[model samples]
Target: MAEILFPALFVLLALGVPVAFAMAISVFVALSFGSSYPSLVVVKEMFTGLDSFPLLAVPFFILAAEIMTGGAVTLAILRLAQSLVGHLKGGLGHANVLSSAMFAGISGSALADAAGPGSMMIKMMEKGGYDRPYAGALTMASAVVGPIIPPSITMIIYAMQDQHVSVGSLFMAGVLPGLLITGLVMAANARVSHLRGYVSGEAMPPLAEILRIAVYAVPALLLILLIVGGIRFGIFTPTEASVIAVFYALVVGMFVYRSLRIRDLPAIILRAALVAGAVLLILGAARAFAWVLIIEGLPQFLAQTIISWDLSPIVFLLAVNLLLLVFGLFMDPLPGVMILVPILAPISLALGIDPNHFAILVIVNLTFGLCTPPVGSLIFVVASTANLRPSALIREMPPFFLALAAALLLITFVPVLSTWLPGVSGF
Candidate 1:
């Protein structure tokens, strides 16, 4: 059953079926082909998978991101990051990183970061003398930060997978790592820019201009602070924070920014709905796939095999990182989370790994896959937007990928990096 199930899914994926439907087909094949179980389980499990209060955050965050993106909040963020960092060596790249980080907190999605600010950043960097592929590389690298920051949909899905972790704790756990990636990428950008002569040598926006940009961006920025602070302080649940984010985005866009008009909302809402619908469908399918594993006892079987190896926690983490990196290259993180967490989380816990630490490691590693080759959707998004080649993007990605490797190692080895903030928050 296992052999028939897993291979059929991959074969279908290779044959161009969507991930969600691939998962659904796999569920049916695994269960119905065997007399041990019935195919009726597929529909039930997929529906049960999405029936959750916490998962409500998914659509709300997508809606909020779409609203903010449509309102030019990303441009405001780019201007602020540019005014602040656009004078340094590789300043445009640095600004790209900074802008993506800011948008990360708002969007909680790598795709949104790539499609929104990321495309604009690539254009800016290209005009500033950066290589186009290099610019796309940096943009792709920075976009991963979106899922690592607060209000992350990936983290929320993870929390739902294991009741031991909460959305708030996971959100808090991501902050330092997000900042850590930001610093590492910026340093790498600066060094490479110096060697490659990619520095823009542009003048900084004046203090007055910077201040004006800051003032204009404050309301947009406040939404992040509200979500982070509210969750950390126990003022609201992460799901509630997502709701607040939507309302706040609407207010800021219509009144403060005056960029999101009332008439503009139908298109924005429709866009958000489509993205959210796709995500939920994938999540539902993943849940059903996971259920198939549970019914077959595959997780216990896999866990026992791992335990039989008597591996240390660090060694297991290293092995997990390698697997996730490969998976990320081909699979989207949503289904990856759904399918793997059930199998892997139990093993990690038995190995005495902190759930928060392991969760962060898994999330960050998979998020970076968005920047990698083959199935990296974000790579295609940026490449399509910038008219750059994936091959050239791959060639230009070494420095940034190395920086990401360093960040991943830091988070993997120093479990404290992922756990400390959650602990400090009293999680």
Candidate 2:
């Protein structure tokens, strides 16, 4: 059963089925044909998987992002980022990266970041005399930061998989690494600017103009600090924080920015529903697939095999990174988390690896996959939204990939990068 199950799953995936449906089909076939257990367990487990409260955050966070992105927020963020960095060498590139990071704080979904501010940045950078492919690559790269930051839908799903990890700790664990990725992006932008001989952005705006932009952008940016601070202070669970995010986005969009029309709510909810429903469906399907693996003793067998190797924690972590990088290359992070976390997380704990640290490493690995070639969803998103071929973006991905690799290494070897904030916050 073990041998036949996984190979069949991959074969189906390689045949171009959607990940969720592929997983369901593979498991259903394996169980009905090979296992002694009744196949009906698959439906039971899939329903059980969707029966999670923390999972509720997925839609709210997505809705909050849609609402904020529905109006003036993206423009304000672009203006603020441009005002602050647009005069630097590669300043437009810098603004593009910076704007995505800000949008990440609101959205926590790479696709949203890519489709929203990322598309805008690509056009903005192109208008500033930057190459189209370069702009697209940077947009996809920066959007990867979305799931690595606080209020992440990915982290929330990961928590549901591993009960030892609370959502708040995972939320706090992401802060430092997210900031590190931000810095790496800017550094990469500066290097590309010099090497490619891109022209500088517009002249540095006056300080008053900068101040005005920042002041106007304050309400939009405040959502980040509010979500983080509220979670850290124990004022709300990650689920509740998501609700606050929605209310805040609504108020700012309708009242402050005045860019969101009252009539727009239905469309916004529908969009969020489509995205959220897809995620939840994948999650349910993956859960059933995971149930098959557990009943087959695949996770335990693998865990014992690794333990018998007596690999040091450092070596083990490096191995895990390599493996996850490969997993990430072909898969979306949602199914990636649902499938891999259940199998690998307990092994890390057995090795005395910090679970929070391991979680961050896995999260970061899957996030970077969003920018990878072939199966990377965000790569396609950036290309279509920016009106370029996928090949164009692939040719420009190396520098950004290296920058992200560097940040991932820093987070992996430095456990404190993920643990410190969680510790201080009493988690």
Candidate 3:
């Protein structure tokens, strides 16, 4: 089945089928032609994949992001970020990076960040005399931080796959590395802005005005603390925290922000449902796909082959990083996580790598793929939102790509960056 499974999957992908359908169809093909197993096993495995209680968090978190966007919480975050960094060199660029970090706490998805606030930042940067492609590129690069920060949808899915780390620990573990990625992207922006002679047109707001903006944004900002702090202190489970996130987004959007209306909710709910449905379908397909791999003993075979190499933990990590980087270029992070974690994680455990550290490394590596070509979802989102060509954005990506690779290497080498916060928070 492995023979038919992989080739059929690649052929479907090359023909431009969506990843979910590609995986599902490949599973059907593999079963029908390559094995005696009934094709009904595909449906069974997909349903089994979606059966977990923790999987309930996926839709709630997604809906919370949609509500926050509808309610104008995203605008408040943009204002807060602009005030803080809009006066710096390459001011709008800096604000773009900062706002992504802030929004990551709320959205938890890179495509969400890129499509919502990231689009807005690109327009603002163009108005401020920055090149359009550069703005789009920066937006795409910075938006990868979405899943690296706490309350991440990726982390939620990841925790379900690997038992050694809980959702809360992954949430806490993501903070420093997310910020590290943000900082590197910002530094890249600063260098590019200097070379291009981009300067700030907006002066720093008065202290009183900045204070007012911060206070206005407080309710939205507190959602992050509420979710993370609540989970860390055992006040709520991550699943419960997701539910609270939706309610909190609702209250903040409709009443506090006054941007969301009662009449607006149905559309918001429908949109969130569509997005969540897509995500869940991918997970279901990935499950059936992984079931094929497991049944064929692909994971055990690869694990044993890698283990027999007698690699050190550090060497094993470098090798995994290279494999994931190439893998990411062809796959989105979510499905990548579902398929690869099951194979790579046990190998890392046997190598004595810390689970939290290995988890973050896989995540950060795959998230980078969202900005790469051929299958880079964030690249398309940013390109479509900003009316820029993907080639233009890709051409402008070298500096930011180097910046992200540097950060990945740092996370790969410095285990503490991914583990420290979780450790201190008692995870």
Candidate 4:
């Protein structure tokens, strides 16, 4: 049964368990020899894989990023990304990668951009002297641009597991790989904020305080350019562009940034419905352990063991970028892209590739496993909001995880950097 169901759910997730109860004990140990199915078809495929209607765009983009980070549009996009990169040369490490690419467009949640602008850019890079574990390792490497931008709740659980792929063409193929990993982590955070001196100098604010922080961050960057230009011009369908980004963040948080009051809307809609009911109960127990690994064929025994190793779609996408960077340093990118993107999307479409460029190279190698150590959820949310010591923010995130594993090996063998804007939006 697919070798005793994914090695007993990777040995109960290496004994720590709890990846949604190790995907319901690997879908009841791969339906323990189904004699004509029905052990109630594993409780009706774990509640019909979260009974999706475009997975209600993952709790209205997690309650419109908890009502636009509960106030004045995340400190007016951190004072317009500190008046356009604070004053350069490591100006709070280029204002912590330009306020994490404008709070990864209104908090798509890399643990809320590593505990909200990585705990205020690691206490303003330790009151400007820096080195609090390299400002908690560049705010956990610009909190992996909160799941690579575009109002992403991991692209709404990868467009509710392929409804012919179009959460606005996977948010326009994550906008130039989230602006090329935010310009390669703000030019490696302005060269380690000018090699450790960690520059501070502030001034540049006035142009009427950068036009009143660009008119209160142009109504939250025009609700992320009208939900990625109304889902790239077709007008709307990332669940109707997440119900027009939760009624444009509730008409700009209750009448233009009044800071959303009605008793803070029922604890921000019950903390975004308890994190979208624990990510739709781990996307309905990893879709009944990916329908028992596609009824046990295991993607044609992994495409005949990679066509008996006659490799060369550039060495099979460089060994599938070292097996998705060792399954993103031990799983979490939406149940490892809902259990290895339909077994590596038919082995990268039988090596021709381009299933939306192998689903943006398996979500930029699962954001390089969130920043690897013992499972790096954005370096354990910037080492528990900068109190520090997830191995001292993994020695300040190994050179921003080696510039995000060299832009995930050049966007995994450059399928034109994720199929050139999903082929100019005509998907």
TM-scores for the candidates: 0.97, 0.97, 0.99, 0.37
> Cα RMSD for candidate 3?
0.8
lDDT of each: 0.89, 0.88, 0.94, 0.78
Any idea what lDDT model 3 has?
0.94
RMSD of each: 1.4, 1.3, 0.8, 19.0
Model 3 regions lying over 4 Å from their true place: none
| Top-scoring candidate (lDDT) | 3
lDDT of 1 by residue, 241-354 (tens): 999999999998988888888889899999999999999999999998888777778989988999999999989999999999999877899899988998899899988899
The residue-by-residue lDDT of candidate 2 on 1-427, one tens digit each, is 7677788878987888888888888888888788777878878989999888878888899899889996489999999999999899999888888888888888888898889988988887888888999999999888888998877999999998887788888988998999899899889989989998887847999999999999999999899889988987889988899999999999999899999988999999999999988988899998998888887888888999999999999999999999989998777888889888988898899899888999999999988888886689898888889889999999998999899999989998899999998899888
Q: Estimate candidate 1's alpha-carbon lDDT, on a 0 to 1 scale.
A: 0.89
Question: Candidate 3 lDDT, tens digit per residue, 168-275?
Answer: 999999999999999999999999999999999889999999999999989988988999999988999999999999999989887898898889999999999999
The ten-residue window of minimal lDDT in model 3 covers 68-77
Q: Model 4: clashing residue pairs?
A: none
Better of 3 and 4 by lDDT: 3
Superposed by TM-score, candidate 4 places the C-alpha of residue 47 at a distance from the truth, in angstroms, of 7.6
Q: Write model 4 residue lDDT over 24-75, tens digit each, in one string.
A: 8766766765335556677698799888687878888888888888648877
Q: Clashes in each model (backbone N, CA, C under 3 Å)? A: 0, 0, 0, 0
Candidate 4, residue 117: the lDDT equals 67
Tally clashing residue pairs in candidate 4. Answer: 0
